[model samples]
Target: MNKIIFFAQTRELVGVDKLELAVDQMAISQLLEQLSLRGNKWSLALKEKTVLCAVNQTLVNYDYIIQEDDEIAFFPPVTGG
Candidate 1:
């Protein structure tokens, strides 16, 4: 299972900080697409927002391949106070 984490507003919108998904070999874009299909909120949060993604604590693009045991995090760009 791959781990997915949501941060900041993403977390509040999704109502969860983390979730585990069982998936086959696929790219991050594909995973986002799959997650978007879960519901309107999920679709809007994932598909309609310009959020950033990281894999295994390393920033990556949407094309990055997600592997088993990988940790994925999503959040919007950070701003200073």
Candidate 2:
């Protein structure tokens, strides 16, 4: 199983900190698309083109490929004060 993690407002919006997906491997973009289908809130929170992502604790782009047991995190782009 793969793990998906949401951070900051992304967690609040999704109402979840983590989720288990029965996927062996997939691109970050593909994962996001799948999660977005959960509903309106999911779509709005995860479908954003600018969402930041990381896999296995390393920052990655949408094309990053993740494997089974990998941990994926999603968060919004950081903004300066």
Candidate 3:
């Protein structure tokens, strides 16, 4: 399983901050597709805003490999403070 963390608005939208999904070899798009199946709010949240994804503390490309026990985070684009 991989560790997935939702931050800021993502967490609120999902109604959970973290989850362990049984996916180890999927691309970033596949991961979002699975999550989007949750319900209307989740799909809407993604569609209505720019969601940023990070894998293992690094900003990643769409083809980035997801491995077992990896840390993934999803959140809206952040602005400089």
Candidate 4:
């Protein structure tokens, strides 16, 4: 199974802190697209804004390939003075 985690505003917007998926391998974009299909709230939270991503604690781009047992995290861009 692959672990998916949400942080900060993305977590608040999605109403979910974390989840697990039985995916063997897929692109981060594909995973995001799948999550967006869950409902309107999911779509808005995942597709309407720029979300940063990390795979196995390492930052990665949407094109990054996710493997089984990988841990993926999504969070909104951080901004502060």
Deviation of model 4 at 75, angstroms = 0.4
Best by lDDT: 4
For model 3, which pairs clash? none
List the candidate 1 regions with Cα displacement exceeding 4 Å. Answer: none
Say which prediction, candidate 2 or candidate 4, comes out ahead on lDDT.
4
lDDT of 3 by residue, 1-81 (tens): 889998888788888889888778998878787888999777755553377888998877656779988899888888768
Q: Where is model 3 more than 4 Å wrong at Cα?
A: none
Best by TM-score: 4
Cα RMSD of all models vs. native, in order, equals 1.7, 1.6, 1.8, 1.7
**lDDT rank, highest first?**
4, 2, 1, 3
> Model 4: per-residue lDDT, tens digit, 1-81?
988999988899889999988765788888889999888878777873488889999889888888889999998887879
Candidate 1 residue lDDT tens string, 1-81 = 888999887777777899988754788888888888878777777763487888989889988887889999988777769
Which residue ranges in model 2 land beyond 4 Å of their true spot?
Answer: 79-81
lDDT of 4: 0.86
Structural similarity to truth (TM-score) of each candidate:
0.87, 0.88, 0.88, 0.89
Choose 1 or 3, whichever is better by TM-score: 3
Alpha-carbon error at 76 in model 4, in Å? Answer: 0.3
Clashes of each: 0, 0, 0, 0
Error of model 4, residue 32, in angstroms? 0.6
Model 2 clashing-pair count: 0
